[model samples]
Target chain A: MIKFSNVQLGYGGRPVLNALNFEIQKGDFFGIVGPNGAGKTTLLKAILGLLKPVKGEISFLNIKRGHKKRIGYVPQHASVDEIFPIKVLDMVLMGRYAKMGILKRPKKRDYTIAEEMLKNVGMEGMAEQNYRELSGGQKQRTLIARAMVGEPDTLILDEPVEGMDIQGEIAIMELIKNLHTEFTLTVILVSHDLNIMANYVKTLSIIHNNTLKLGPVDSILNEETMAKVYGAEVKIINISGQKVIISKIK
Target chain B: MNDFLINLEFFKYSIACLVLMALVCSFLSVYIVLKRIVFVSVAVTQISAAGIAIAFIAGLNPTLISLLFTFLGVAIFSIRFTERRLSNESRIGIAFVVSSAAAILLVSKSARGIHEIDDLLYGNILAATPFQIYLMIGIIACIFIVHFLFYKEFTAVTLDFEMARTSGIKARFWELMLYLTIGAAISIGMRTSGNLLITTFLIIPAANGLLIANRMKNVFIIAMTVGIISALTGFYLSYYFDLPTSPCIVATLFLILCLTLPFRFFYRKS
Candidate 1:
């Protein structure tokens, strides 16, 4: 479980996230939905301890700061230089940095785990391929595999499906779903696409004006809530037993 | 060629300088190359050059001024250009433009008798003094110490800083080391290779090394070897032809880089 109570973070002096409170429980596939600069990424960074909250406390399943390696992260794709010369297999091995210990080369067990994780992601064939050469979806899968190699209790993904085609998106969504069930891992995803969230995740949280509203999809997918949160009119329609938001008004 | 090769002290100094520069800059080259901060180093050297030029103009010790200005540049980068604010390349570009402009302005305003800043622009490695030798040794030791102390942190931060931080490594500390290492290299090597050519030693060798090697350790070794070879060949070629040493060295390194491109293609294909 991850808990953020009264979290407030800012740059220089201005606040980005203020009086923010959210808790994620075990086996929860929570999708964080928010507009740009809604502090969704900041919230994730806050949870990861990448940014310290000036006013609040964050506790992860009773674990302290140094012991949070059980938390795996797949940051936004924009954050990394994909043109880096490293191969796909090498990136997976990097997941063992915490366990490999400082100054020690990754051991045989590390390689074994890395190989197994790549196989799990169906990227075994492209193990030695340069990271820069991989297609967008494939790179995302490889990154996911890298994160999963750490075997974390909580897996956090910030827009893991961005820049992917429809088929690629579905494949990744399915992979995440399978991984969540297989590992019984708590998954936190930040995305702007409401349809993707409604279809794949068990719960969704909309972040607006530093306030986070989290609950089941059915309860929170109403017209009033969408209008209130997104400041846009959202017409919900049942299409072949699936809830779809037909259009979002200005 | 025979006359230049026969001078034992020249040979010794050139060889020693080549080895030290190769070892230090080869390791650094990859980080700068991967980070795409070549312009940053260039900008820093220009700024440091400007600082030195200004100090010379004002009748102050240029080396002291250069060091102070280098520290100031590092500090500015640390405070204003966090990983969040700017990519390493953009930050370096900003530094490059500002410093180069400042250097030009300072040079233009100073009296003709003020020390020629061009020497600092293109280095005088063949005429390196014992003081410069000691400075090189000190810089090399610092590089080794910094790399040894923060080997994992540097690798992790270089590869993925956010991941490094999440893994409980202090990324900012290692990043500071990287920036300091670059500053130290420029400060010590600026007199040897000047601002214009220093980046060549810092980048070319490492890039050539990366063409053949995949791992970081192998990359460092291969790059150092290439750097030494180019430096030696540059020294001999310049001496024999009675040519400018720094540009000759830079050209030799560039020639080698061009030669390696075909091998890279063949290796990739195979």
Candidate 2:
């Protein structure tokens, strides 16, 4: 569980998102949706401690500050170089590095966990495969496995299915959904895909107008909020009790 | 072969120094190439060379001077550039050009003049003494131990800097450590192996290994192997053909890299 108290996030004194107040309950599959430059990634960076908040405090209910090992993060796939010569298992083994401590090599147990994580992600067959050779979907899954292999209390995924095909997106979303229940994980996902975010997430936060609107997906993802946030004519259709968002051309 | 045996005693120290320097540089090359900081090595080498030239002009110890200058450059370069106008690459490029120009000017003004510059650029490995060999071994051993102890941290930082930071690893600290190690290696390596030879050793073997190897461990092993093989064979060729040891070794490394191209192609296809 995490609480942000009047948090103001920015870079170089330029505030991107201001006066943010939110509390992420444990085991909640919380989704943060917003337009480009909405400071969603910045919020994630603030939570990850990579960027300091310009103002306010971020308090972890169960974990202390500087003890971020309990939170696993799957960064945007584009952030990593594909040509890097790392094997699948080695990339996954990197997850256990925090627990392995300094000067100590990974033990047999660590390797076993890494292998198990690969299996969970349906990448056990490719453990010895070069990571660069992996398809985009496989790469995303491998990254997810890497994040989950650490066995963290919280999992944060940024654009997990950004460049994937529709099938790839569905598979990844299903995988995350299953893993969320199976592991009882506190999932925090950031994405621009409002449709998937609307259907999957229980609670969603829309960063718009330099502030956050937090509520259930249905309330937060209506046409009015979507138009206000995205500056586009959008329609929210209820299909079989699931919310489907479609942007209309001007 | 008989000629090499006849001059075995003379060649022994230089051979040991080259092999050790090659091993160390090859190991660090993985990080350099993987992190895409090959230019940083070039800039650091140039800075170290300039430091040595300045020391030569001032009649001070060139090794210590070079190390200090290299560390200074590393510290400055490691700081994250806040100004968006000047990219890190542009900064490094400026550093490299200025250091190279300074080295040339300083060497031209020194007593030994251009010949000293040549020696700095293409080192005289045949001139290595047992004391220098011992120093190489000691320094390389320290670097190896440090890398071995912090292998995971180094790999994590090189693989994903932000991920490492989010996982509670001090990415900046490790990055500084990486730059320091590279600085120390370039400083010492450039002295014994010269700038051209050491830079080739720092880059080529790692590139060759990464071309053919899929795994990180294999890449390291293949790189070290390439380095050792190049040094030994190059030493023999230099002895038999009456060539400069540094250039001969670098040429051998280039040849080996070329030879691995087909294998890389085949491996990728498969």
Give the alpha-carbon lDDT of every model. Answer: 0.78, 0.88
| Best candidate (score: DockQ) | 2
Share of reference contacts kept by candidate 2: 0.74
Candidate 2 lDDT tens digits, B1-270: 776789888778888888888899998999999999999999999999999998888889878999999999999988886455668999999999999999999899777788899988988786788887778788888999999889999989898998998887788999999999999988886767899988988899999888888778889999999999999998899888988888889999999999999888887688
Which regions of candidate 2 are displaced past 4 Å?
A64-69, B236-243
Tens-place lDDT digits, model 1, residues A31-113: 98887788888888887788778788887775666665487888766677753667888888777777777678778888889
Model 1 sits at a Cα RMSD from the real structure of 3.6
**What 10-residue stretch in candidate 2 chain A is worst by lDDT?**
A62-71
Candidate 2 local lDDT, residue A39 = 88
TM-score of chain A of 1: 0.93
To one decimal place, how large is model 2's interface RMSD in Å? 1.4
TM-score for each candidate, following the candidate numbering: 0.86, 0.94
